[model samples]
Target chain A: MTIKRKILAAILALALPLASPVLASEQAVTFVQNNVSKVLQVLSDPALGDVQKGKLFSEVITQVTDVDVIARFVLGQYAATASTPEFERFARVFRGYALGVYQSELSRFGNEVLEVQSVQERKPGDSVVLTRISGGALSKKSRDVKWRVITIKGTPRVVDIEISGVWLSQHQRAEITGIITKNGGQISAATKMLCSQSKTCTVTG
Target chain B: MALAGCVHPPWRAKSDPLEPMNRAVFAFNTVADKTVLKPIAKTYQTITPKPARKGVRNFLDNLQSPVVFVNDVLQGKPKRAAKTLARFAINTTVGVGGILDVAKAAGIEKHYEDLGQTLAHHGVPSGPYLVLPLFGPSNVRDLAGLGTELAVSPLSFTRFKGKQTFGRVRLALNTMDRRVETLQEMKTIRKNTLDEYVSIRSYYQQLRKDAIADGVVDMDELPDFDLIE
Candidate 1:
């Protein structure tokens, strides 16, 4: 190949990949902007009614969500050892539990409006961290919830999220473990009890 | 980052419900996950979903059901009805692969109305809202819930149920999964730890009040300690 052609090829290759991350990041931004707005809508306009809001919370949020990711976090370090079966189970229970909790909280979503502070490339590759929201302090402090998007192999995935104010994973672990301990240290027994109370689980039958 | 330096009060009885020191510890604990953990969890949860996912949570919770029974006993709280419902629900869910849908379908919902909530229900007053380093947000009663419940967490079950450590895996996954779901919120909070902490605590306290009292609390009724005011 001619030198000119070779250089052109290289430029095209680099440009496309670089462009990919930007595109990917935009996709995530659009996802949250659109979907979160939907959540806010129900929150803001009480007249729209909760039946729709409940459906959105249960169906839409669940469909677009990555509960396995939350399950992984809820697991803390335990995800490493959890088998495929173990991982999957956590995802379901956690997803249902999360949905239940969120379904309860979405009523407040309208009251809280998050602003995007900044969106920047975290890595040279196709990953961008979009910083959103704030602590709303006297200085009008700005807090960030960073959404990470990158291609794993070839497919894009939202690999991580960082919220500045809390170490949610550990907090959850402590809470779950706390429940277990509070129950006389029977982790299985405690976990089962918690799940059974929820309509989302098979525990009731 | 400025919020990380304050000292944490002993686990109970602080002057302000949201103290700088307590905020500091709470902020410290939340920074990374609020920053990274939840997103990672979201990603993980998104990638995998099979049938087992349904039951794993229930199975693990069933294993932990005894704690409910014990906590009920400890608080000297009544609601033997709630206790029976919990036992039945736990039994069925654990019988299957941790799927609570069946139990829920049958009409038994999880109601962790331990002695603490009972006290709150009985007009013991929530006292002041406090945010513990690791304990997110709680009033004295819920804080006591954490303290009292910790006395019987499933960690000890790790001893006898070592054979069923599978439950531990479920516990961890549940934590990670839920964390990921809150990624967007946590990330926002991390950036403004103090403000976010205060807001979250305020909102949460109100939420609990709603959850326990009316089963549906409205935002308008809450103390609007405005973000600016």
Candidate 2:
């Protein structure tokens, strides 16, 4: 090959890979923005009752969030210790808790004006979509929240939320770890704590 | 998010029997919030610097830590109780009377346990839901539990001269601060809901349930989202 052709090939290789991440991250932003607004509409729908809303919100959560990943993350060190059944139970319970938390806090930002500010590739596998939520005439405060998004098998999902520099996954990890530590490092004890706390968790063993 | 093969029963209880009375009180409270509380909160937000307002909130939270700690113990959550106590001590001293929230910096986030939750933890069912005018959502059990907590809270009965006035001011400020924080959210709900009363009641019920569950929800009911796309 000629020198110019080799140089062109090298530049093309570098530029193509570099440009692809930007495009992927941009798509991630679109995915988050579109899904969040749709969820807000569901929350704001007057035709639906609370139960229906809860059901719809849960669906949205499942689609948008990497619940299984978050579940394992919440277990933290307990994941290594938990039996397969115990781990499965914990995951189920964690998913429910997270969905409820998200549903309850939906209205806080749902009504406000949301703007996607920027999207940055956080690491090799994930992108961060930054957004600003501005309160209307009645509210004076504005908040910035970031969604850590990752693509799994061509589907993008939110794995964490960073509100004011605090990650939701990290917060859950702290809480779960605290429980396990308090219960003397027994995952079952933590499961019992979760089962007692949450009505959704029928698995008590 | 699958409704495939699940057997979790409905978690909601038919707690509100006095819908008519609750609706009336809710209306009254709405009007009061619009005319009185909202304006005051708006003005307070406008006048107060962000840092000072945050400091005020921190201070109030520090004060309430004792209540949270007591409730944590009552709920038999030793970890939460210890964390609450540690947060209180660190915030009180290092946070400079809780004006800075140093404990948060130290990784001790706030643990918000209340007597109502304590009662729920002990299997005391949430009897008929009640909406008190100006105070917002509550159930019979929570209302009773809140009454007891208030009675026991040290901040309720100040010992210094002009104690009654001091207590009243504190209560008013706390209410106003909360109103300010939730002003936008309240406005959104009102704008979005066709029947504000029903929506508020429903939301409150669900919120209380989630709290009782310590934020856990029933995942079985969630539908498939793939069809939407």
Candidate 3:
């Protein structure tokens, strides 16, 4: 092939893959533009209440999301050791837990805004990507809510969620695993405790 | 903060929690990457056209003196290649608009375009999505490529140059500019995507897998829809 053809081939080849994602987003973007406002309005309305917010959560974003997919990510390394029964039980417990987490999060979405601050960034292990999400919280006065979000595979599935400087998930995981290790070093008991960590967020899909 | 509430659907993440989104997002990302960003980058490349300066190549290549010097020491060709490219890139980038022409003129080119793109073209898959701070959309293998670039690139050797503050600043400025460009892209991207978190994760994985497969892994190319969450 000629130099031009090679260059063209290279360009087209790279172009094809990158473009597919960007263009596909156009439809997604259109959807957001059309529906995001209404969705936000419903979520933000004081009169809408938790019941209404819950409805919008499922009707809009939840429907499109495969929450089960996200739950698996949050489980992290534990998935490997989990038996079929353990895995199924954990998935069930965690799913409702995840939705409850998001619904409340979504209800409070525009209430307290995030202001960008300096970042403490590091790309973690090859399988998991860890980003220390730091920012200021804007309610009436601007206080900071510095947190770390570990995105596994692409989704910002919070692995070690931090509030201020406190590492919530890491501490929780350590405590549970520590207990399990203290007991008999079995993975199952530790996972059970981890599954029931947040009672409110625990749902069965 | 994973506050005090979460009621995710049953059987989420299939015991993994991150895999399903990883898969869905990759599937979504595959379409956008191939269909949009890649083409835009190409057009941008054509219209902007970078041409390398004469001695700039040697100066740039000479700057890679440490790269060749070290890689020869390290016994790894990929590291050596990365160091050479990053050094060239940092130089051209800091040399005013010197980058485009030089990259166009030859000292440095989009190596991923030449090698990675070809592999991707033949059906290679990107493994998973990764969201790097200040730099969006990369994967495990690519980041390793980047870490190697950062670790040994000749410009990084300037602190060792003993009397070259200007060279150090030039490299720093280049790094800063790249970070800024990436952040700008992320700001826009945060607003795009059908599912921001999911899309980003999935596409990144797809890209990584594609790179690893030496660029060939044929699979179902799912068409777009109104309900891709």
State candidate 3's DockQ. Answer: 0.02
List TM-score per model, in order: 0.41, 0.53, 0.31
- Per-residue lDDT over A38-147 for candidate 1, one digit per residue giving the tens place of the 0 to 100 score: 65455466665666767656666654445555556555334455567655654666666666554543443344446654455544323434445433221334444544
Query: Over the stretch B1-229, how does candidate 2's per-residue lDDT look in tens digits?
Result: 5773343322222355666578789889988988998999999999999899899899988888999999888888899899999999998998899898988887776758788888888999888889987899898998998899888778656577888887788789899999889887687555433246655665666556556666432333221222211
Model 1 ranges off by over 4 Å? A1-205, B1-18, B50-52, B64-97, B153-171, B184-194, B214-229
Candidates, DockQ: 0.01, 0.03, 0.02
iRMSD of all candidate structures? 14.8, 16.6, 15.9
Looking at model 3 chain B, which ten-residue stretch has the lowest summed lDDT?
B219-228
Q: What is the DockQ of candidate 1?
A: 0.01
Best by TM-score: 2
lDDT of 1: 0.53
Encode model 3's per-residue lDDT on A107-172: one tens digit a residue. Answer: 334443333343332332111111222222333343333323333344332233233222333223
lDDT of 2 by residue, A111-165 (tens): 6676898887754446778888776531766677777788877888887776544
- Tell me the deviation in Å of residue B178 in model 1: 2.4
- lDDT tens digits, residues B76-164, model 3? 34653674556555555664433333443444532232223333445444333354543455654455546766666555665554446
